[model samples]
Target: MTTANNANNNLSPWQPGQSGNPSGRPKGTRDLIGYVLETTDGGKELIDALLFIVRGVTPNVVVQKGTRPRKGQQVRPADQLKAIEMLLDRGFGRSPQQLDIAHNVSSRPLEHLSDEMLKLLVESARQLKEGIGGGYW
Candidate 1:
């Protein structure tokens, strides 16, 4: 029986300007993984593991409590390449990709074109649609 306005009003307890969480996530609050990496030995271990992978060596890191230790296996060339890429990306940010885009299409407003130009444009479009002339489209 509640109207749309009443439904919206009940959705939020705070007033318009008031924030639901006034003191948004404590300034130094970090996620578990980030905290472990920053404060504990995990960060160094992670870098070491990445280096080991790059070098085709199986790192002696425990996965589960009861599982048998992993035997040294030849790391795939693709995997080693990926590890190298990850390390480079983390150490010195990912390389910027260069994109070459060539735009040849005209985007002039219809009103800006002369009557004769507009007619020619329409004829060209009609020809293109009918498979008469060579066009990119």
Candidate 2:
């Protein structure tokens, strides 16, 4: 059985919003993962390999078909998923996710809503976000 590890919170005396060392690592600073990757021997090679796989340059990686399964073909779940995604993305195209009200309004005629109505909608949305509204979702 593994023992539970306790954090030494009392080690740093600094309170909230106060730092012991102010001139620490600046904002937008990346961690050692990137640095390690850059310094390591097979890092570039690994990246190139990953890119090659993603780009579908390597012959025997995943599904060969861009569309969904037909006839009596041996189906790999991962490949099948990719095929479905590829088919939809390339053919019908992926639709943008809307907040509650889905579908493109541009295609359908929209009535000009009043300022009060707009405000109410915004307030309702805010309430939904804050979990104040009766969340059906």
Candidate 3:
């Protein structure tokens, strides 16, 4: 007869889409956790993880998506660097030594962040700061 070890070898680790609930969260648990998990609050943990990883590779830089500036609304590279420094200071509660770190790990700068992208990043950072013991939010 097949044993549990045999079953274990055959089955892959849990995946959300494999089931109705991809997070291995039980069915209907999504109904309850969905609001929280799908929300800024719920997703803050993941967002923070991503940001932390980016911060780890470089001290004073943040990686973000690239986008074109809106008409009549321009952001210069210097200002973008300043904004990144400000965001890092606010989120980490520490002073940044430089406005922007050279692409030590990535080729892009934060200025390339789009309005929507920046909005989400700021919101995520804000939510995480507030949710955690960090008081910068």
Candidate 4:
């Protein structure tokens, strides 16, 4: 179709990691986190969960009026994930049975699912974002 051709023509010069302008962020500086899932369903679920937390509550965002945005709290995703896992382990005895039991019935033990997990859940709500395609930012 002519429309498809026009789209391709518009995109022809813009290859991945290519800039028409020579100056940019430079190589290896940009950190892009992409998820590889075993199944589409698994991928979707992960994406959904991430989206949910991001949209619902962004703990890092400090509401300020008429001022430039402040630097966000610096924490690597891997570190955050590890902290969450550790907290879950500490709170609910690192076992499938424990997790299942906690989920099936509310208990004081499950209250300790780590602040990080709660933050992630709030920041990334399970809904597609506008313009950025799918998943939470």
Candidate 5:
């Protein structure tokens, strides 16, 4: 059995009043892209444009494929199904998958039956086995 050292395992353990990752990013620090965007003057405008695109504040226009004119056609509003899937995965997690079951089954022994009954039981068992391409008794 392999024993791992928790302190040296690289993940920061919880402390009483401190965040788990004290050595990592500070509390108010944004990610690199976010920081860059927030710092830039045109970032707000760019973000507004993206928001408009996502929220359909403005219409979606895509060019029609395989045409000489290739004129722009207005598309339907975007569905946020991927966002829902991401949120569901992060919040409640995914569900366990069901297993496929084989149809093979077994029956009890015929030792307690009478001699005639035992003969009939054997014959019936044989027929059942043959019907299902046979398996062990």
Candidate 6:
């Protein structure tokens, strides 16, 4: 039977501590998102667009070089809802999810458990994580 070290060695072509690509991603090439959100005004523009949608306001757009800004159609309800969700998600972290676990076993220190008990505890924890059983022994 192949050990973990042997399996890893078989999978990887390069030696340990050696990078697969010596010349990695080019230097001075910033991520597109970083460039848009940090370096440019795109982030502010995005926030403004979201706010406009949430407020049901029509965004203004310039038609020509000298022409006055024209009012676009009112933001759709679906789009407004999506924009509100996005703004809320960005402004505050996502809401917490509540799990309905029904475990009967109270928490105990690992050092107090025997080897067999430890194995059972580990299996019980796994079952709880997978939402398999209602309670653990």
lDDT of each: 0.79, 0.57, 0.57, 0.50, 0.53, 0.74
Cα error of candidate 2 at position 52, Å = 0.8
TM-score for model 1? 0.50
As a TM-score, model 4 comes out at 0.19
Evaluation by TM-score, superior candidate among 3 and 4: 3
lDDT of 6 by residue, 1-137 (tens): 56987888778477899998898977756676687788438588778877877899855533377774346665789989998999988889675555675875557667887999989978988886776754433
Candidate 1 RMSD computed on C-alpha atoms after optimal superposition onto the true structure:
11.4
- Estimate the lDDT of model 3: 0.57
TM-score of 5: 0.24
- TM-scores of the candidates in the order shown: 0.50, 0.23, 0.20, 0.19, 0.24, 0.45
After superposition, which runs of candidate 4 have C-alpha atoms over 4 Å from their true positions? Answer: 1-73, 96-137
Off by over 4 Å in 1: 1-31, 38-42, 105-137
For model 2, how does the per-residue alpha-carbon lDDT over 10-32 read when each residue is reduced to its tens digit?
36577999977798886546656
In terms of lDDT, model 5 sits at: 0.53
Candidate 6 Cα outliers beyond 4 Å, as residue runs = 1-31, 38-42, 61-72, 102-137
Top lDDT hit: 1
Across 78-127, the per-residue lDDT of candidate 5 in tens digits comes to 42344344445655887554445474434545565689987876887797
Query: What local lDDT score does residue 134 receive in model 1, on the 0 to 100 scale?
Result: 45
Which residue segments of model 5 deviate by more than 4 Å?
1-19, 26-35, 38-42, 51-75, 79-137
Give lDDT: candidate 3, residue 65. 57
**Model 3: per-residue Cα lDDT over 1-137, one tens digit each:** 47988988987775764665555745787587777587547767545544543443222222345643344443455655655666677678884333343555235577887889889867877885886523344
